[model samples]
Target: MSQGLPYDKITSAYAGTIVYPPKGTYGPRMQQDLQLVLLHTGELELTIDGSRHAVKPGQAVLLKPQHQEYFAFAETQESWHRWITLDLASLTDEEQDYLDKLPFSMPIPEALNTMTDMMLALQNDYLRQDELMRSLGYSAFQMFTARISLTKQQELHPSVVAALGYIRQHYMEDIALHDLAGAAGVSPEHLVRLFHVHHQMTPIRYLWQYRVLKATELLSQSGLSVGEIAARCGFKTAFHLSRLVKEQTGSTPSDIRKAAWGTAN
Candidate 1:
């Protein structure tokens, strides 16, 4: 009997798929929302930030908010995926912990088919205006988290935590990789390697992520324009800020402001 996280509610979300086997680049450069991929057939390689992971049939991948992601099929690849996404604010801390332990992409077995089916069914029912589907969606999400929790936990190295903390505190200004490496008391190269292994991105990428996250808060909560926000976030220019935001969030400064306003109202 697994104790699942409590959820206030769950609502049906948009669903879509990308069929492969004959194309050039076909995936979005970056995603703005939470995304889930259910692979039904073939293989797909997903690049989340700078880390690469392979997802196969009977497996799934969940993309967290604000992460940069891209995917491509191998040549002669036969791949089909069923993807759907719901808002991530619905996940509790306990459920999020479970999710963080699992690999970005992992296999799903037939034993969990019923739970997956329930999610699919809820997606359909909720889209069709069946109010009860919300409850079922939340239940299905809890079950998914429980399954991930049953897997072994991966310990975060002390150095990684220290480095993460350093970034969180000092991301606004320019900080060298060697400075972080020295703080962690490891060789610069080793620090880069280890950070990539655990954090799934280079230290610089993490720094950028931290800056962007801060910028987002300022953008939404403060009355800052693109130029002001860019300067505050340590970006050289508004264009640079726009480029980074587009790369990481698939949206520009104006768009983010609009989105913030939309949410507020």
Candidate 2:
């Protein structure tokens, strides 16, 4: 661990992977720090106090400190898991408070999974001597923490939650209103009304709007050209992407690129 690191960086306590044989169990033990676990194979059933959580593969759970818990591996299979532990004392008070609000468990996004795996790779000899590598490890931990924490003011409708996860996972595809409705497990008209109630727009409108938002990020940061970005973002043509960017953001892609970077994107 190091001192005087930036707020966006972290000094983690420990991180590593574990594997358990069938019917194996651990704990009746106590947690010492905030930890995030990513289960990779088989099922995990964790009982904290008296409540039980059944986590599937590709899912993650954030554990708080000071809880008595038991871990049960699948009765008929092995379980593979990866985790990163965060020391609360290493983070600022604001950062500590933010961790308090994360969902106990959630699906791991693809980007977050990559970041977590990268962080775990560093766990063997993490920050033993190199200062810059230490800082990078810290920032990696910070990145996953920020990603897992969904800072909504209120809980969204279950249908909206399902639709949002679907759109985010497949925004590059040519998605239709019916597809969105089907993913949300609602009728097309019902999904539209729900979107209007929550997002103040129809389901289809939100999809394109979200596409424009993704295009803006690429325009401001990625090296991809407008035409390539359009295809990646589900727009029909470069002109279509440009027109929407101009209409929604009051700026052309070129202007955004120039202003965002040093005369380029």
Q: Which candidate achieves the best lDDT against the true structure?
A: 2
User: TM-scores, in order shown?
Assistant: 0.46, 0.50
Each model's total of backbone clashes: 0, 0
Span of 10 residues, lowest total lDDT, candidate 2: 1-10
lDDT of 2 at 65: 68
lDDT of 1 by residue, 1-265 (tens): 1122233323344455567873324555666544567788777788878787877778867666556777777567667777656554456676656455544655664423443454454444345223233333343343354345335234666676677678767776678898788778888898889877765568777778667757766765688888888887778888888887655443466655553454311
Give me the runs in candidate 2 sitting further than 4 Å from their true place. 1-10, 90-98, 128-265
- What residue pairs clash in candidate 2, if any at all? none
**Candidate 2 C-alpha RMSD relative to the actual structure:** 10.9
User: Model 1 clash pairs?
Assistant: none
